[model samples]
Target chain A: MATKILIVDDSKLARMSVSKLLTSLRPDWTRFEAASADEAIILTGREHPDVILLDFNMPGTSGLELAAQLRQSHPHIPVAVISANIQVEIVERAQEAGATFLAKPLTSPALAAFLDEAQARLSVTRPSVR
Target chain B: MNEFLEQFLIESRELIAQATDDLLALEHAPKDAARLDSAFRAFHTLKGAAGIMDFDAMGLVTHATEDVLSTLRAGDRAVTPKLVNNCLACLDQITAWLVAMEESEALPEEADADAAGLIARLIPSPRPEQPAPVPAANPGEPTLPAHAAAILQEQIEVLALPQDEGTPGRTAAAMRVMQNIFTRFGLSAPAAPTEPATEDTARPQRMDMARIETLVNLAGELIVVKNAYGHAVSLAPSPALTKLQAQLDRLTADMLRGVLAARVLPLRHVFQRFPRLVREMAASLDKPVRLVTEGDATEADKRIVETLFEPLLHVLRNAVDHGIEPPGQRAAAGKPSPAIIRLSAARQSDEVVIEIADDGRGIDPAAIRATAAKRNLATPEALAAMPEPELLELIFAPGFSTAGAVTNISGRGVGMDAVRAAITQLGGRVTLHSTLGTGTTIRFHLPFTIMLTRVLTVEAGGQAFGIPFEAVVETQQFNRKDIAAFGAAEAIIWRGKTVPLISLAATLNLPDTPPAGIIHTVIVEHGGEWGAIRVDRFGDQLELMLKPLDGLLSGMQGIAGTALLGDGRVLIVLELNEVLK
Candidate 1:
């Protein structure tokens, strides 16, 4: 199976910029976007994306809350919480929820490291797909 | 130049306008919570978009403004006109920065100073009870985190406020406190602005008017070629050829309609900008006026809507400048104190009628007559003989103005003439109507669409011409004996009415046909003027794409545009109104 990614951010520009960067880096990867956490959850269920990049501050069901829900439902899938506001509380909370915290605006090197880590984590946990 | 960045710029521009409008609305209904939330959201969205593109200056300004809006929403701060003005100024600055960014892929050099200035102005005038002193960072070290750095810089600028010169700053200390709290929680520093991989970035594309025009033109060419092919194959028609032709015809017609539909846009795109304009004009002129627009959702061809902005703006300026009375004068005249300017657009059959009406002292024919005579536009007797409507029409005459003094806005006498010329250039006509004390209405009748026109082709003077079907009332075959010479012109009796008949060949300076035989005449009407132009013969009516004449032939009075005929000949579409004039 090809690598599938989902980005959930209320800002359209953030979604587009991140998608462009990801596609350029991993040419074979498929990308999807959702503008809200509710939509993000629904798309994740339907697409079963391998990984998710979620924004921290949203109108409702913020990234931290959604991260906990996804961790409970799909432990094998990695969720990277992308945020502009990164406090220790959020970072520890996200970590406790079995998700990683990534700072934005996303740069090339940081994104590569995150993806490499995600790939290793995914490959180790899932036996059905390499 | 990347698609994401380009989209960010475009979306930011729109959000700035939306924020400004909502801020202004909130100024009126200060307690409207929903409107307040909407205004705050616009700023928040703008800040997020700017952050994505790493537009630090824009992001900082919007962030500060968002904070103020949030305070208002939380009922911690009052919504004052000063606050609204501050918000509007921030929107204006963002708009300018966006424009600069569009031109050069970065913000302007003075962006920092402008943001600092606006941030300084955004600080509440009244001081909070107790201020927290900011912890000084070590010299030559960057102590603040990235996100806090932007806010810290703004707060440092706030330290220079004249009234708060000796006061300790809460903003910087607040940022420090937040950063320390985050550090205590064991979180890493905030992310720096991302530098994506160096690749060629294509701009995000939208369906703008120029691209639509190209599509429309291509569709038109397809039609012309299809028509030519049909004509060629008709001589030796077969079942296969007929079937192919029918399919091609349906495909091309569908393509043309689809392209034309894509070019339709609601008038609100143009109408929305005017509320801001009217508000500014009201403030500058100190004249209380209300602008009411109707039928804003009416749609028109994209090209027409784009070209209408200037002409509509000119007429509207004229209404505010010359038509509307001052508040004092209006009250004395027993009219409403704040004058009303109503701009309404409606689709009337195949034409769009736009009316700019104002409730004020109407145009005086005697004043126009005096101006016309003084400007040498007409002789004294001629001016007297000119009826009230015709006298008012003099306002459109070049270099004619009845104003005794020239002001900043409209009195240089150059407005209405240009308005009429522009409308006429688009193959439309404009007229004026005014009662002594009621008001003045300037009406423009424009073609519903400029791309394709239905016209009747006529052959005169050994050349073919296309007459718009809308102008052609009827066609008659008259014997030469029925035509009578009247002074320098000729006339014919048709349906108990005497219509002026002029030989098309003579008028066009073409080879004269023999007058001894039957004459073909096509009657045309343009703005209450009816006449018949004699032609040699008539051809089939066609829906043709009108391509305006170019270069030196562009302004030749009677030629509207050129169209390609199926036989590879060019047909001149006549400006029948101009010809009649």
Candidate 2:
């Protein structure tokens, strides 16, 4: 089964670019996009994606807030919060919300490392039947 | 261009336009929260876009602007004109980079330098209550000292060794050892796995200008051949040939129209830059002035649009420097305190008319005459005999300036003559009109395109060359007796004025035959001075497309470009300014 990933950002261009990067890094993984935190939350409930990528800056319900909310309900999924403005306080908040902090202009290696870790955890907890 | 970059350019340009509009609106009503929020969102999105492209320098600039805007949004800092101007400057830099990326499909080489300068300017003053924002640090990588790394390696190696059943606690013991090492080195262990450094393998494909130029040249050559074919058919006067020729003419005309349309761009690309510039200039000069632009949507060839900035900048500087009087002087004169400088462009039948008008002190013809006489640019009798309009034209004379003291703004050796020369090189004409106290207007009449050039071919030393027809004032045959020697130089009298003369053959260091009786000369004007060039004979005038020299002959002085003639010969065109220099 292919792993499903959700990409969320306020800007459509940003979402598209991130989706492209993710596809190049993991060709077999499935990707979904949302333009806001609300849409992302709705999609998460519907798709049950294994991993989530969120943009920190948005008009309503910022990425960190949504990350905290999702952490409460879905404790098993892995989350990464991305932003161009990476202040120390923001990093601390992301950690407090049980999410990983990634810098913007996300390189392939960075996304690949996160996905690799998620894949290992998934394999150990929910092994596929042969 | 790749699809990704094409999309980038299109989206970034829209963002820039939106940001510029919001900023301009905010300048008028600084307290408008809606505009402020809109502007902030624009910058934030632009920053995100820059980040997605891995344009680090562009990211740095937009990030700085975003921080400043956020501070304003938080009500911590009040909106100021300086802040607005700085933001606009940042957008201008981004726009410049976008243009470069569109042309080359790669990051600009000067991005770092531009970013550093702009970031310095964008740095906001520190508030006593809030500390300055710290520079971002990479959180993923936790570097270790060489000795500490060695110690960790030793522990890992020890753990890897084979052990008996009694040494089952070896893994736990090695973990304790690593904790001790971390404590001693004053470093915290990484919270997550570290990623190895990876090279970026994605390189955007670039569009080649040389290929495009070759295609354009081929198209021009085809047109020339088609014209020749028509001529041949005309000579024979065949009905079938005439029908074929008419069909060919229609197809060629359509192709030419398509090509020319692709090269046309709106004037806004150049006009949008003046608002920020005028603001800075007004602030520096301590004058209350406003800039009003009209007909920015008018279109012109891309070459004309790109080459217009410098000359227009000089003209605007002059208008702000000498044309506009001080606020106190304006108040005393009962005119509006904030003087207006209007920049307008309109398309004429086959030309574009651009005018920069200033509603301030106009040119005083008497002052110009007095200055001309004092500078010895002309005799007192000549200055007295000249009309007012002719006297006003004296400002364009080289080394002729009426400013009492030189200011850094306008009069540092570059005069109106340079502006005229630049315009003339583009097959354009510039004229100045002024009323005593009402206003002054500088108008430029420019061609719609730059591909075709009308050249007057001349032969010197048995080799033919081309001179731009616009630069040639007139041609005359002077008797050898009339040519007088002046200190190893030759001079000729033309229209009751003594003009210096130089032999083109001698200047070019070519073998020449000495003249016997009369010298065939062409009088050319450069930088407002008339000089005669002696040649063997003048050839037929022709309109041809000029191709700039490339590869080996690139940057060659005194030669502008090469044009192909009808008989398969190459005509070398001269850059008159450099040649005369």
Candidate 3:
């Protein structure tokens, strides 16, 4: 019952090194960080979770207006972004808004192929918020 | 998460000792509205507890230390000491990545993207880190020791035992207080102590303050080799080189100020988080406070008791948000609906006072002379001829609030200009007083160590400055026809007071010219005004070393940092809070 995950950054050491690399890939994910995009829209208004990572530049707000305010108030919170300023129209604007990209100094096999294709596109859509 | 990363490394070491006593109380009282509201609530509670402990490299280095403490909390930049030692080395690299994740169970989070590329070089977008030959080191050990060799070059490994089964009563009460500090330092306590992650590198190697500043530079090079063996025993030399340089400079400056008084600490780590911030600001304002504290063992200088803990937690959260009271207005002002405060600490002369006080509803000086007569900042006949300690020092100005509203845990005034720029960058001074319904101290003082001062020695445009001794106030030798000419500017008039002059070639834009006549001045002062300056001479008083003004002439103005003197040269000092702006 873990997979919570959010991890946006403004870096407290890259959010404690991707929260100690997802707590060392332990009891499977829980992390969280949002220092801006008004705290990932107040942490997806306190719930919308199951994968986010994000970070594309911070300061006032901008993770692409927090991925268009999490695609209009949490479009089933997908996001992945992550960055080290890798451009290509920022992965073609996070693949034209439908999120999921990685390019950063981030390792662990590019965060395990972004949690294996965002857990097969969240088990075909929302799958109980993973 | 390891008790929220040990309460966010004891609240980012009390917001890096409230940004090093608000950059040493804004270097002796700069535009202090209570040290820029305690460096904007210690970088807004260390960027809101490093964004609720995900620690994104200490929440993007405290969100660029809350945009340089909200640009010195809206007075738009001034609190310097190199931006309080680069937000105290980004709270010593988030306390060396929380003591490398409490001694490695692993979490140097691979030095969190090289500590967010050294906190995006303190904020100036277009990212990258190449500039490591200087500035806050650690890019690849450019002279490391900061975070003491990044927490003694991390290799720690001990996170395996405590599954919390009475964690062996917290590792046998931290091994009986490290065997009572190793048998009170004489060492002998290892009788039967062998198991619990014992030899994985004892890195918290205590004896701190940079090992008591290398035993105060080997007790000042053994009192300069006992004053060069009392000048070679007044030339009568050989009493075996004057009793071996007076017994090796009296047992090395009494064993280096007795092991630098074991890195003096006490003031209970500066009153350990003010009784949990006065029981969470008197149970979130239903009021009924208490607090107390007093000297809490009163020692000093472990970097000034870790920077008088967040400017005495924003003077006990402005004595529980605007001096206590609440519970039915302290029983309709007859008092006792619950309030107390106090807080204390001692040591004076070469400083460390502290205070805090409170009781309830005190400060009012007509709500700081009607918020400095509604921000025109005094004029209703100068707020009716000011004085009541200048109307309780206009409740430390800035955006002075009496707090009828706006507050999450402190009125909107912003913790008295960060407790007067963290006790004026620690050469210190805060003062307040109050009194109305009666009760409110404030105080502060500081200098147990921003590390030495005194200064004076002059010279001006042909360089060499230093100044300091509380910005001087007297220097003399004028008459190049009493220095007048006010077009390209340069006034003087001295005694009956006329002041505003500049000269070391119009304050260092330099081209030379002073030696052609007999003109000297110096003056300095600040709160009331006095500049005089015009130098070209006066050099006697010595003691230098302050440093901090480099990132290549920090965009020069009237210089305020650079010191190396003990007969070497490089002196430059002046920044009396950017020459009182």
Candidate 4:
């Protein structure tokens, strides 16, 4: 099955930029965009994306809160909390919320590395939730 | 700008606008947890955007603003007028940074300094505790054993303190504990005092506002000089001079167009400050006034936008101080506890009209008439005969005070009259419309561009005068066949409607007698009244630069400014608004 991904951010540019990069790298993958955490949840319920790329800070629901909720509701899907703020506290919160962390202003090399690792994990028959 | 930077600028500006609205909403409803949360999110998103764009200075400021909003959400701080104002100031600084970013694609040199000052104010007061001193890692000291490192990592995992991925050492342990201590002491460790990556030089260069203004002003002067040169070319009649004049004219026009494009700024530059102003004004006066701003995207000349600040302040102050009743009175009247003052702007043809309307008790015509009569400023019969609007007009009369006593809030020395004068000086007009028990709307009609104007030059009182074509309905000859006498005013029947007529020579105190036969007349409108102003003769329509009259000529009632004609004569630019009024 083709890998499905969901990208959530309040900034349209940020989401488009990441989506464009991901499509250029992996042509077969399907991508979904959501402007808020609420929309992300709705999209997840409808589409069942295998991996989620969420911005740490959003207007209504923060990434940590959404991640925690998603961990409870969608245990099979993996999540990555991306942020430009690499503050130590935020990183810890993301970990506690059961999401992997990714730094932003996502250069091609960094994104490629993260995607390769994610694909490897996906190929091994969906890793169990921590 | 590259596509990436362009996108960044666009997104950052929109976020700033949303953040401003969120800040004002929080101020309006302090208990509305949703507003506070949204505000925090806005700043947080902006910080992230700034970070991706390499605008560290802006990110720093937004980070601080976010922290303050976080504190408010946590109930560590109350939402006060001062706090809202501080947030507004932070946004203003961010706006300045955006301006710089547009010009240089990087924050200005003072970005760090400005962010530091605002962050100092934004960060909540530090907890009162003496921090344990951090021990510097000495190279000579032995590193922690593998067993000891493992034990330390276990403790960190249990405590949930962030773990550095590198293998643990005694030095790393010390550093982690120090960071933990700072976090526990409720302080952000004055991070990024060392400057972040500097401005990327590869980005497209942006011009600053001052430089743009300088270019615009220089271009305006060149147009004036070109007119004078065209006069010289006509007088001297040389082929070379004529050719040079044409080239110079084209160059000046192009330069002016280019510079003026840069000088056009949105009305939000001025409108953004009103939320904070009204909020503070309400708090100080013990009256609840909610400010609603609209049409912030309406664009106007930069100079006009700057000059709008004072007059807007005066009108808003009046709305808050004298217009809106106290909360108790409003509640008794079955009105909303907090009155709404709407400040809106829109482009109307060649003019931008800004209206400040309040939902409060409107001006009392009786009080105005009584005040006029008691002050002996006007006779009782005149005051009684005047219409309600005319009665309200008395408020703009110098020394007219309808307020029972002067208060520090608005009515001290300057009244609505001063507001009228200030706006008038900018070649704009102010008028008041009120309905008793309803509200008042003070409207200002200002020219869209102050640099250049399309005017019809007319010979009035044997002197050249320029009248803005926007205000002119049409021109016709004043014939004896259609003339009639109306009390002390001259009237003419045009299209079967009686129109009042005023001789420009007489109104301007020029030495010219009214002609008996046909005379040149231009019909103009001001404040809903249309009238024909008779002049000696009509001249050519010219696009001219209007240099405001200074010194002795500055205070002239009807003259807006002066421009140079191609014939080498100075043309007095008539403020048609004032002349018609």
Candidate 5:
């Protein structure tokens, strides 16, 4: 089956962007979308999605902390944070929390290429990632 | 600020000042309906003003603020200090916008965040439902007024679309007809009702912020390319062979000027907020200070005016807080109880001179000396020997204060140093003169803008170097006959007492020493003293575009920034005073 991924963001524009990017980058991939952390976690438990892309500045728990929680709950799944509030400390904290970070406003080409490389590596190391 | 946003900044500043004054007056009477009405009017005017300026982004934010003010004015709520403070915070964000606009016509990080906060506060918080509608006031106005924002935005958009081009026309016209009806009632036009229209609304076309930054970066890169090409032409065999080469050079220079002019903003934008600021400060302190301004009509290189705002504000604040004593104190000193602060500007030769002066309690030389002693800043001997101007200048010194205790307003050490640093960064000079209890005047003479600077080129250690021409006090020839040595340090008696002298070559650690002949000495003054710099050769000065040194290269002492000579030779512009320090 196609690689399954989850996208989470509170902003309609941001969520739509990540959804469009994932669908266009990997047409064969299955994508699930959620607006908040609680939804992402519930969906993660249900679908066991390979990779989760998170937003940082949501109303409730930020994307980085949510990714950290997901890592603790589902140790095998890899979480990535995509955010616009890119400060030096936030980048450092994201790295320490064990999630790959992508700065926003993400260019489509860069997002597309990043997914291609990431999916290939996941297929080799963790077939369960996708 | 760009011409448009600058117009926005100035008008908003005036509204804020008027609003602050009216609110403060209300505080005295507490039941003055007329005063409250005027205050409400100020907010409404500011909202409408923001719309008129086509600064819809900020107008919407102000519009939301106006809603809360309008609601409160209807006897729905009372004005408190907390509300005033929120309004002040909103003013501050707008102030930040001026600064950002000065540098780039961009907002400072989330230009819209404050507006959102202000709007959120205006919409009464969810509480145990009251019979009517009202809410608790907060510490600051939202950076924006979201309530009026939608209405103002639609109005501005309609206005901005140009009278002829505003019709969204066929398909989309029918689409937004419902939104147009809903939004006319001062409601937020929802992003989209369905997915299909949502896609259309998502496509925004008015040059994105990234695109503006990219344009600037490309322009900057083009200059680099132009300079490199010129360098190649200079090195080519038969350099003067054809008119094509010179024509290409002139064309490139013209293009660079055009690019720079694209960013040229008027000084009135930077000055616009000050008149209101002066009025507010005068009203707050009850000092009756009138702001007399000149040169509001002069044009400045845009970036220069932008950076000038903070330092100028800091100086103006000091004038209001400490420079002008209270009415009783001023009268006691035989000066006018109502102090007049004059902010005047003029183009002196090629530089712009801005003077902020007040006729009140000037920088007291005795107080400065005492403060210097308390801070243990200057030696007893140094204090005794220093000139009055030098003593008055001590206010800018780090950690030196004359105040007996720290007040939120004046005793802070950031007063003059920040001003000096900012002006110096823009290749400028600031000088101060004060009469004991009479008054003080601080003049900042700066290049009309950033980018180009006039510099003195001097040769030392077989290398050519540049330093800001303003740093040079005078240049003279020094022989053993003209100079005499003092203990440990050398000195030259110019007026009476000997001034300290240092060999520039020795100071900068250059290889070339003064030849057996008479050495050319350049006297540069920094802070409040003069020092002589020795050089092997001094050449004609140059006006060149200086490229700022990277943080790594910036830490190098005695160097300000670097500039490339027309021949492509890189030279360092020295800050002589920094070296002496």
Candidate 6:
């Protein structure tokens, strides 16, 4: 089965750029987009994407809070928090939630590395499916 | 332009508008935390967008602005007029950059200098009592511990192989490696958690104005085709054909209404910018004035809403510079300080009525009379005999200025006359009412829409043309002897008044066949004056979707636009006002 990825950001341009880069790196991966934490939560439940990429700073709820929540409910799924200027506190909190931190503008190499790790984890955790 | 760049420009403009609104509101209520937060978010998002686009200068400037906003948000700095002005100025620069980017479809060159200047202004100066704080490390570089770093490297290799079964064993294997790494640092592992979700699937698509305009044009063409169909059915009338024609007429009317409504926009688009303008103007003129707008939600055709800004700006300038009295004078006149300029709009019947009322020294009829005489606009006896209302009307005459000395704001020769001319061109009328000591009110009575025009077709010099029905007062036939020649001009008596009579064919330089006995004349009104146009014959009345001439004939005077007649012929519509002038 092909892997699925969910991208969340308030800025449509940012979301589009990430999707475009992800497509170039992993053309077989299916991509789902959300513009807010609330939307991301709903999409995660419905799409069951294998990996999730989120923006750190949003209007109502920060991505850190959402990442923490998603980690509790879907521990097997890998999540990455992406932001332009990643502060130390945000990175620590992301780590505590077992989520990866990636700096933006997201280059292909960093995203590919994360995807490689995510794929490895999925294969080990879901060997029956494989 | 590429999609990302186009989206950036659109989103940047929206953020700028949002930030401007918040900043302007903050000027009135400095303690409004919500507005401050909103403004901060807009700047933060703009900064992030700039960073994504690799616009280093814009990112740097917005970052500086965000720092100041953060200080304000933290309650460390108080909002001040200078702060608001600097923010607004920064937004103005960003607006300029966005415009350049839109034109060039690339990052603006030479933005570094402008961004540096704006950043300098955005960074507030430290007070003498407080010392400048040390700069922190760049947030982009976060320091990580060795063990935590090991997990990032170890996880890649630990999860590299696929297991056939024993999912629990594999999970334990991954956790055991993390546990062993944590044991080396004498630390514990963290646990994870999740939740339920609600669904919302309301997604609205945004349509650009050009696409909407294309739809409007198509709707207009459909109207023309429907009219042609109706005409064809009329030539050979049958019960069935008549029924089909009626059905087609109703459907076309409904679609046209919908299309035109799509072209209608709220007057708020034009009115929202006035409060800030009035604030700046009041500060500069040293006159305390408040701009209060009402009925901003009233909608009008997009063209009307857009074009209204210029004429309204002229009126507002006049109201601020000449209409509103200074604070001292206002108090001496037993009026409250900070004079009010009210801009209100409403839809009445088929017209949109906009009124700009100012509470200040109104136009003095005697002063207007003196100015008219001084400027030699009329004879002294004529000025003296003019009614008070007629004397006040002199303020709108060309080159008329009642200001004792020229002011930079309103008295550089473009006066109320220009305002009147602009309104007139938009198929609107401007009327002014002023009470000597009380105040002045200017009202604009404008048409609902300019799309579908009702024209009366006429044949002149063997060519068919259209005259806007609103301009035609009445048409009549008179004997050639009734026209009396005065030197090079001719005059005719109509309704007990002498109106100018001109041959339309001759005016247009077309071949003219003089009337042998009786001549067909169309009496027209333009700018409160009357004129009669002579035509070869009068034709049918038509409701046409008038398209303004473009390219070579864009600015051609006396021709308003072209329209298609029901019988598949092109009709040239005349701008009677321009023709008469």
**TM-score of each candidate structure, all chains considered together:** 0.76, 0.58, 0.30, 0.60, 0.53, 0.74
Q: Write the per-residue lDDT of candidate 6 for residues B7-112, one digit (tens) a residue.
A: 8877887777678778888987899998998998888889888977999988988888888888998989999988887787667657666655766788877567
DockQ of each: 0.34, 0.30, 0.03, 0.33, 0.01, 0.39
Q: What TM-score results for chain B in every one of the models?
A: 0.79, 0.63, 0.31, 0.67, 0.62, 0.74
For model 4, the docking class works out as acceptable
Q: Which stretches of candidate 4 lie over 4 Å from their true place?
A: A1-130, B1-20, B29-38, B41-68, B71-262, B402-404, B425-427, B479-503, B506-509, B513-517, B529-532, B577-581
Q: Better model by TM-score, 2 or 6?
A: 6
Candidate 6, which CAPRI tier? acceptable
| Maximum-TM-score candidate | 1
- Encode model 3's per-residue lDDT on B453-482: one tens digit a residue: 557877766667777877787888777777
Instruction: Give residue B202's lDDT in candidate 3 (0 to 100).
Output: 16
Better structure of 1 and 4 per TM-score: 1
Per residue, candidate 1 scores C-alpha lDDT tens digits across B1-581 of 76766778767766665676677678767998878877887787787787777778878888899889978988999888678867766776665555556656765554665676577668745863323434437664434434444554664564455654223222222233333333322345342111110000111224386688789989999989987988787878999999999899889878887888888777765665565566556655788877778887787777677677778877877788778888888888899866888888899987788888999789988888877888899899999998887788778877785455676555555657888888876768999999878999998898777767778999988899998887899998899899878997889998898899977777777898756788888998876778888888988788788887898768787888888988899889988766675
The candidate that wins on lDDT is 6
Q: Is candidate 4 or candidate 5 better by DockQ?
A: 4
Number of the candidate with higher lDDT, 2 or 6: 6
lDDT of each: 0.75, 0.76, 0.62, 0.75, 0.65, 0.79
- lDDT per residue, candidate 2, B1-581, as tens digits? 76667667666776776687678668867888989878887887788888777788888998899889888888898878778867876776676677557556888664675575567667844742333323325664445555446657876885787876523334433444464455333557432110000000001112243455456667688777875786587678888999998898778767765676556667776776676567557766899888888999898876777778778888888898889998998999899967999999999988999999999899888888888888898999999999887788888888686455576566556788888877866767789999978889999888887777778999998888998887899888999998989999889999999988878888778887769899999999954557888999998776667776788767776777788776667888887766675
The weakest ten consecutive residues by lDDT in model 5 chain B span B195-204
Position B456, candidate 1: lDDT:
93
For model 1, which pairs clash?
none
Q: By descending TM-score, how would the candidates be arranged?
A: 1, 6, 4, 2, 5, 3
Docking class of 3: incorrect
Kindly report which residue stretches of model 3 are placed more than 4 angstroms away from their true locations once superposed.
Answer: A1-130, B1-100, B104-276, B279-311, B314-329, B334-425, B438-454, B458-470, B476-543, B547-581
**Count of clashing residue pairs in every prediction:** 0, 0, 53, 1, 20, 5
Candidate 4 on A36-74: residue-level lDDT in tens? 999999999999998899988776688889999999998
Give candidate 2's iRMS in Å, 1 decimal.
1.9
